[model samples]
Target chain A: MSVLTQIKQAPAANPIERLLLATEADMAKVNALILSRADSHVEMVPELARYLIESGGKRLRPMLTVAAAQLFANGTGTAVNFAAAVEFMHNATLLHDDVVDESDMRRGKPAARMVWGNKASILVGDFLLGQAFMMMVETGNIGALGVLSSASAVMAEGEVFQLAKTGDLTTTAADYAEVIRAKTAVLFQAACEVGAMSGGADDAGRKALAQYGLELGNAFQLVDDVLDYGGQSGTLGKNVGDDLREGKMTLPVILALAEASSEDRETITAALGDAEATADQVAAVVAIMERHNTLARTMEQAQAHARSAKAALEALPGSEMRSLLSEVVEFSVVRAY
Target chain B: MSVLTQIKQAPAANPIERLLLATEADMAKVNALILSRADSHVEMVPELARYLIESGGKRLRPMLTVAAAQLFANGTGTAVNFAAAVEFMHNATLLHDDVVDESDMRRGKPAARMVWGNKASILVGDFLLGQAFMMMVETGNIGALGVLSSASAVMAEGEVFQLAKTGDLTTTAADYAEVIRAKTAVLFQAACEVGAMSGGADDAGRKALAQYGLELGNAFQLVDDVLDYGGQSGTLGKNVGDDLREGKMTLPVILALAEASSEDRETITAALGDAEATADQVAAVVAIMERHNTLARTMEQAQAHARSAKAALEALPGSEMRSLLSEVVEFSVVRAY
Candidate 1:
């Protein structure tokens, strides 16, 4: 009896957990669709795609899509297709990013590029993108397709823009904000917007959800910035400080640079983008960031974005799904805290 | 008088020129659309995209799209978008292919990867793909979008499949044919098929154009295979024997392996995929292929496919565009002769 109860009563203690519990059945279908679509006659495609997809992602973006549809309380059944398509787009972007960033690990495993080589990783990303569009076309929802497609182009521009600004100490907070919006928030925005459209959302509802996603995405990115500088736990993991090593001008760095002493700036610049920088070098940079309290300021800004995200939820009717969506945004922003 | 005549009478000397002459005004718009859509606020995106787009290869795929659309008298003008989209798709594939093949040159210039780095080339490729889909969505022709999207996926599959069989000595003739069809032919098939669809080709016309494209694509790739092995001029140019060096299981190699002596096989195997394979080594392999007469056999197959391509055009009523298409097919296959 105890074993049966334990198996049946999965914990929903946190907001994401609760959200997951609420959308478990829907996500199961979404998972099935993702797996089926990821299948290909070419053996390496599925092998690489699966290794990445099944590697420990929380499936946050697709869940937002499904939850958005559920919040609308109606759907044309295209929501499932949109949800799966959104996930594919996300995964495709990750595969490309792995190559673009020369990332050796993803979600705590060897990146697909490591397993299959860069060429395979890239071509599989393209294949998944094709499969994504095919699924969207199958829905015959051209409006939603347009939104997602436009978001995709915009997202690429964001990445390129960020690439241009890498290691620029003069990069302002505004620049980081724009990059985060374009490269990070826009995908989240498109996922929710399209999900709402597929779920029969009217103009106002779609706009509100779009705003919600964009703000949530910004908050999500800023918090990630904080985590890279030693989050609320104040412990540096191996993966920590990767952005700095990559010479990325994230919010924490931008905020810290605004007031950094020349000597501190030198310390930061030397370690920045040095592939072989020692851990002590990174920790020294972290110490400067701490002295400036930039991580805390970044967290405050994240909380503000998170608040705006929840405020956007007021535009929609109150429902169990709506609260879960709001809480998920809250859960995401406070994660570093 | 000479200058005026040179400017005025841009001679339509070849079948492709005739097609170009026939579709000049439409292709002008297609070119306009191509340039406009390739424009991105991201500086590197347009810089890299234009470099590849402006390279000296004739705009063959987009021209095919324009010609196919013109073949049908009726049209909704979405063919311009489809043509531009097709070109972007082609360019995007080339950008990706540049990285995948690790080739040093494309259309006689340093590959885009060499100029901007592989990451930029790949991201720009993804950006172009996104732009392609956005243009297609703007047209609201789901059918054409579906065709192009599926082709994109199939083309990637063909590439992956080809990569898998790169050095397999036991690869069959059938495998080579399928790879060429998937990797090379489907884009051509999709180009013409989508064009005919946009142009309002009736069912029979559409089917005929599709068949024509598939066979023509096969011919085109076969000719390319022959060209890689000393082409029509019979001189071992700098680029000759590239396919053998890359260990590509193209038709010439496939057919030659079927009849090679053990000693000849040893020579071919030693040079296959050897990046540092010398002129002497490649010349020795070419000598083996010549004795086996595989290049000629490959050209014969190309001619057969070309004949089949021209025959498919017989289903349509004779017209200037139709004749131009037929001639283009003939002109494509006999390039090596």
Candidate 2:
């Protein structure tokens, strides 16, 4: 099944049906806009740019943008533009982030940086960022532009914060949350909020959507952290222990190390410090997480965020879109891939 | 004398006057604003955040930003914000550029990456970028945001273009122009255009200012390139032949290499390829430039650009500011430091 198809089928069994339904209700439209928006920039090299745009990533962020707009604009069509804008923002960040991380592989494919070289990757990422703001300007939405630029600023700040915290085991959950919000969730939140602002949702509706995205983003990242530890490498489309190899201090590892005996903590810390940590050593670190149930404990926190995200949706008047949003919350908890 | 004091005292004696007046008229207010925009979020270490901002360096880009605004605005005060915005953009690039270059020095001080580590530098750069956009957004001027974002995209593109062309002697003046325009001139253009837009200049006026800035920026970079080779080391405040050591394919070297014998070209290219070109080899390369009159040839091109920049300014109504700008063109061509 296609990614969207799998999402559609799983909604009935999901606890957070509203989340998925809201996202699903907008997915077809959001995906269509994303696929077509490239037509807007014929001046750029399509051959080079298409690989990234057509890459079969889920359109969650864009959907949130559109969904937010829909909520605020009294169900207007501005959501389509919001969706495209958010995706551009996400893709821009992804392209640059790959370079910063020196990451070679992403979503089971060679990353843009690896395929195109850092020069191409960095420039293209920049092109997309400019294009994003251009779209926002075209929308003639001052509030939307404010939210996006602010969110982007937060996102970069958070990424830098994470960069600062790298390989440091003293990192706390609060610290992790601040970085995660900036790095991942702020865009997601902005995506939804911009969507709402476009839809002319009253201030209150905009706030609700913003809260929902923030919580959902937190849940999404927590699950991402869990998958880094225990998910099947093939299924996750990430190398086993890629996070450990990268020396990224994610919540599972941070929490696991914090709770470990001194000897085990020393081992984890030493592995983090060494640039050349072996796969066996990474596996050993994973074993420590399992022993501490850090992944499971983190999973529970993810569940709490999912619940908060779902509850935020309760403020929205019921619609097919609202139901889909609820499903997104459950999908956040149980998705294996 | 302190840099600021020296800048203030030399108001019309060529370089000092243009630099100091520009700093006073454009950067003073903007620098104050730029200094105040840091995030005070409990999680962010403000001390670390302020490292680059507090580090004393000439606010040249910000001055350019303000000058552009002043010319466009023509007695309006809106240029101050644009000035700050442009400087923010310049500093953001510097933060990233430092990391990419892996250099450990700036203005005879530890580079942001050197003092704070690459992660901090990178993150702070991201923060500055965010702050730049935020400042633009506050203008409530979509056009301003568009100009700033477009300039940003161009800057990154130029960086990549330069990166791709490095050490490739086959690169032409046209290719070099494209790289320099992207890397440097566009921001100068944007700085001017954004000022015009804020100052309510007609499209013609805005276009004129942008063209002037672009030409001036080209001249500015050419002079910088020349200074790297031609200026006294201490006065230039940069290591002599620093660009040569860095393998930067600046205009003088490119021009010189173009005229060199096959053996000379090979020797220069090989020296460039080595990560550590000796000081004696650098001096030998300089000797070749003196022999071939490449420095004079390069200066002629810079002078031509300075002339074109002056011609562009003729479109603007003559005023004290206009005369100051005219003086800057002459200053750019003649300044030894």
lDDT of 2 by residue, B1-337 (tens): 3334544566646653455564574466776788787654634435555676677666666665565555554543666777777877787777777766667677666777676766566556666677777787787888777788778766776776676677778877777777777788788778877877777778888888888888888887787778888675654555677777767788878888889988878767867746588888888888888889877777888889889989998888886566667777788778754
Evaluate every candidate with DockQ and list the scores: 0.73, 0.39
Model 1 lDDT tens row, B1-337: 2222432365557877766666777888988888898898778888999999887668888888877887786752788898888888888888998898887778767889999988898889999999999999998989999999999889888888888899899899999998999999999999999999999999999999899889999999998889887765533222777788888999888888889988999999999988788889989988988898988999899999999999999999987667778878888877776
Candidate 2 wrong stretches, greater than 4 Å = A1-54, A71-81, A115-124, A273-275, B1-26, B39-49, B71-76
Instruction: Output the number of the TM-score-best candidate.
Output: 1
Candidate 1 chain A — worst ten consecutive residues by lDDT sum? A1-10
True contacts kept of 1: 0.68
For lDDT, the strongest prediction is: 1
Please, what are the lDDT tens digits per residue for candidate 1 over residues A1-337? 2222332365547878776677777789999999999998778889988998998788888888887876675852688888899899889888988888888877767788988999998889898888999999998989999998898888888888888888887888888899999888999998889888878899999999999999999999888778876765433222777788888999888877778999998889998887777879989988898899888888899999999999999999887678778888888877886
**TM-score of each predicted structure versus truth:** 0.95, 0.88
Error of 1 at A103 (Å): 0.9
